[model samples]
Target: MTFSHDPVEEVARALAASGLLLRGGFSLGEDEAAPAGLSGAPARSILLIGQAGPAPWPHFQRWRERQARDIANPLDSWSREVIGAVAKEFGARAVSPSDRPYLPFQQWAMRAEGLKPSPLGILMHPTYGLWHAYRGALLFENGLGLAEPHAAIHLCDTCVAKPCLKSCPVDAYSGQGFAHEICLGHVRGPHGATCRTAGCLDRNACPYGTNYRYPADVQAFHMAAFAGL
Candidate 1:
């Protein structure tokens, strides 16, 4: 159809219509930050929202253990389709970091963009908690709008005890960053600690966007993958 329209508005409206919430706007410049496939996107605006919940949500600890369900659904179908469309619109393909070839690309996405890796990569967010997840994106030619990322007001910043760093009996998260191997052992090894009991201490400790925590099963599944189970 080749419909001519304001690129940003088109994306915004489309996102809104798809039932994805607009949380905040962020930009990854030529080198500062770029996703796995964003090298090909056209110039377009960035939209941010929690997808379902309003801002100023609760803290992570507030979500109790028994409250979660066993069924796992991350990012929701609507969210996935919307993100896929956005990536395609930008002339790039959305690739999950789990894809072997894209592993380096995923690492680059984090190193280049300052995103920390968590067990949550495979999990999705509901209310921006477990129902939310990021699809490593690449852009071909599309120009993403200049917008600020979701406020760093998330939990990582204000943690006092830093349970994420301390909770892991294996010390998976050293002062520098995630200790991938150690984490794998604890979750996958016969000697591995009971992940279900300890839970994701790091994620659970974070204070920011608590309302965006992943549903329980999703969190466990992601942890298991990181553990290589």
Candidate 2:
């Protein structure tokens, strides 16, 4: 189907209504390598889409609750369906971060939004801070004039407090890298109840995006998932 409006704005608006954001996008050169599953597709451009903050949490929570009645992996399934529908509307292919062969979502986000990693390794958004996430992306056969890459100031470079490093009781994060096993063990232990209920202390300790922090239920959901509950 032919689009009468600017496809990028149209898609962005539609996604926004669903509590998702069209984070940014970029054009892929003809010779640039495509990710594993997309090698055969005539993909020319990509639109990075995702939830930015707590604005999407209520919508997502309702969706999850409804989907949980009958669906396993509600979060992934919901995200795929939402992104898939948008792709179909725009005559593009939908790809998710959770997809096999794992698309370079972090690299894509960095390139698309000019983001840098926080101490915890999560990409620190200029405005959203550590509260944003890339749920999925849309690929089209034809190129759309995507937004220019942002030259946002890297917030971490100036923050002297760096509370994310000091707040984790288990010291799960450090300059050396994340202690995954230690984090997992703590999350699974009784002492992790607070973390399980309120989300990672280190993540919550971030001072940049307190306004965008996920609500309690949403944070609890993520923590439970992290703890494998």
Candidate 3:
């Protein structure tokens, strides 16, 4: 069932009004497993929906202010609502990173955007840097005539200073791995005031996308969520 117009373009237009972008997409090979649809059938292609920077913050805040108090996982909830609407309108299945059993979103992201992970495991985009995020995705039963993701030059490869790894107050990130417990413990302690009020020092240290950095309030919200405060 093909449409006269490009469905991908139509979807992109619809998403733009909400400050979401069609990051990119890929078709699934017959041998590869696909995410199940609402009817429990496999989707043939997936288009990632996300924000490049702080574009969606204002919209999300507006919706958040109108919601009931004590809403758990407010951001995730909001993504589901917005992305779900888009999916419904386009006859697609909506999925989130926080979904149960976790749908390999990181792997999907790397595939879709040709983005390589930074030392912190965040996909670093050339333009958006460490500030972008994958809010949700639209899965279609049939191909949407999406273009293949193109590879970009890795920014970290050329970065000599690598200030991000050194900026952490607790040295949580290292070659071995991220010391999650230590990082969490520090964020919950008294000295965490800086990180709590601003954001992760390491993330802020990234040289790219300074203009696209998340606002202080947004960072605070995420910090509070991270520390379970």
Candidate 4:
């Protein structure tokens, strides 16, 4: 049966109905503005940022699984699949961030389509407190505007410790940027200890969305991927 709803609205509804809350359109724009990592030749895109459902920790954990693979994070595969199906319905291709040069895209991504970080963290919420990730994005052959743009908010400006930078024992995130080799070292090392035990060092540090914690097994799986395992 042909789906009968506005594509963007349907995407938003589908995401919410799936127990995932949509972030906003600007985030997608930000990612696009950033160095796209092989998004299969960007045309225009309809951005959607979403997070797993909640109330039950297990469900929340299940949702975050979409971040990586190896173990059993259903969310990782689940979301990509969901996005793929959705994009197909709308004549678009889902793009995983890994397909392109990530770091080079960071600065632009940090400031996609004119969306900037705000004090309420309007730009930061929706997913993994900066620690969470873009496993991939849906690239539409044509860009479509949402019903309306997300209102600006300032959640991050109030943040004091900025623990996202300092919380890491190994200092994986430089705050100004990332330290890849050092991060992968522990992720793929003999022990593969702390990170596996906790989660992403920088990711865990973010104060936003205290509820979006990924289960231990899920965390381990993602770290393993980072190690190229």
Candidate 5:
């Protein structure tokens, strides 16, 4: 199955300009959740696309500056626009994490990248930590023959301190689950400036991947959106 060009390299090149990296992908199994491709047939492979940290911030900001105020889900919209273009170029279908009746992205992510959820319920990467995200995926009718994903040590398992749980001002996360109202209210309130400007105290406390952590401005943008502010 020789080709004129390497599909993976070509796809990666298309997304690199937008600060989206190919997070790795997998060939769909017969029993796995199969999303329809552009041709409306079940897709055979999926290449996850996302940012490691603040890589997409500049691109997103450029796009945002041109938009009217109060645009809904600006980041998601940007992701779709960027990823959709790459998908169209490759004759693939694009899907986002925010898609309704959402595909099992988390499930697929763990399978594709050997990630597991942290105490904060965000997928914890050994190197990228919680700072990374799965923005969108390109679903193809034929396999791209991507390399197999490798397993890594789950950082949460060995961390005895577990600072992520204790740093939240309102104790928003717990064994029970995230306290949405409590967390939202605090971020939107006056005293929430620390979190609003810096980012989730809990997520920031995870010492595993501090090198890849998001900057304050990037965190502020997401926090503002989360608080509807």
Candidate 6:
């Protein structure tokens, strides 16, 4: 089936309808090298796909429900399946963040989207605040002539209050870096119920993109997963 729109645009539209977005992409050449582990599926370029804010939450939830009826690991499996289908449509190979020998998604995200990290270590999207997430990427054997990535203004720089640093009850996030043990302990404790049911307090405290915040149920679902519940 031939598509009238640009291949990237066509894929982006399809992904958007499914609650995903083409975050960005890059060509693999002399200046931009492909990762070593990707030898099994070498590609001339890669397209990074991700979930922006709560847009994909409902779609993901519905998919999760349907997949849960039969699959033991619905979320991961569903992500792989959806991204794989998209890759197939474009004649590319699908890769996920959860895959072994991790593909340096964070680095790819930073390079592909020119994004910076938030206080919570999650990449702070210029418009999505701390609510966005990378799902997977598509690797194509040839360049798609994707647009070049330019640095985005780091939103955290202009915020004088820096509420995210102060919102965590256990001080899990700060300039010193995340205290993983403390954060985990708090999430597993009795007082962690609030966080476990509503998501990270620090993340929720971010002033930017408030309208894009995930629904409480979606946040709670992620919190539950983080707490290993």
Count clashes in each candidate, considering only residues at least 3 apart in sequence or on different chains: 49, 0, 0, 19, 0, 0
lDDT tens digits, residue span 1-229, model 5: 2345988888888899999899888898768768898899999999889889888899999999999878899999999999999988888999999999888899888978989999999999999989899999999988777766888779999999999999998999999999999999899998899999999999999998788899999999899989988
lDDT of 2 by residue, 114-215 (tens): 898999998998788899888899887777877669767899999999999999999999878999999999998978888988899999999997778888
State TM-scores per candidate.
Answer: 0.53, 0.93, 0.96, 0.62, 0.95, 0.92
Off by over 4 Å in 4: 1-3, 15-22, 26-45, 49-80, 100-123, 126-128, 141-143, 147-151, 190-192
C-alpha RMSD of each candidate structure in angstroms:
8.4, 1.9, 1.2, 6.4, 1.6, 2.3
Q: What is the lDDT of candidate 3?
A: 0.89
Candidate 3 per-residue lDDT, tens place, 1-229, comes to: 3555788788888899888998888888778888897667898898989998788888888998999989999999989999999888888899999998899888888999999999988998988999999998988888766677898778988899999999998998999888989999999998989999999999999998888999999899999999899
- The lDDT per prediction is 0.46, 0.83, 0.89, 0.53, 0.90, 0.83
Judged by whole-model lDDT over C-alpha atoms, candidate 5 comes out at 0.90
For candidate 1, give the lDDT.
Answer: 0.46
Kindly report the root-mean-square deviation of model 3 from the true structure over all alpha carbons: 1.2
Clashing pairs in 6: none
Better of 2 and 4 by TM-score: 2
Candidate 5 Cα errors over 4 Å, as ranges: 1-3
Better of 1 and 4 by TM-score: 4
Model 2: colliding residue pairs: none
Query: Candidate 6 lDDT, tens digit per residue, 35-79?
Result: 532345457778899987778777777887765365555667777
Query: What is the model-wide C-alpha lDDT for candidate 2?
Result: 0.83
Model 6 error, position 105 (Å): 0.7
Name the runs in model 1 displaced over 4 angstroms. 1-6, 12-82, 85-132, 138-157, 190-198
lDDT of 1 at 162: 51
Candidate 1: worst-modelled 10 consecutive residues by lDDT: 54-63
Ranking by TM-score: 3, 5, 2, 6, 4, 1
Arranged by lDDT with the best first, the candidates are: 5, 3, 2, 6, 4, 1
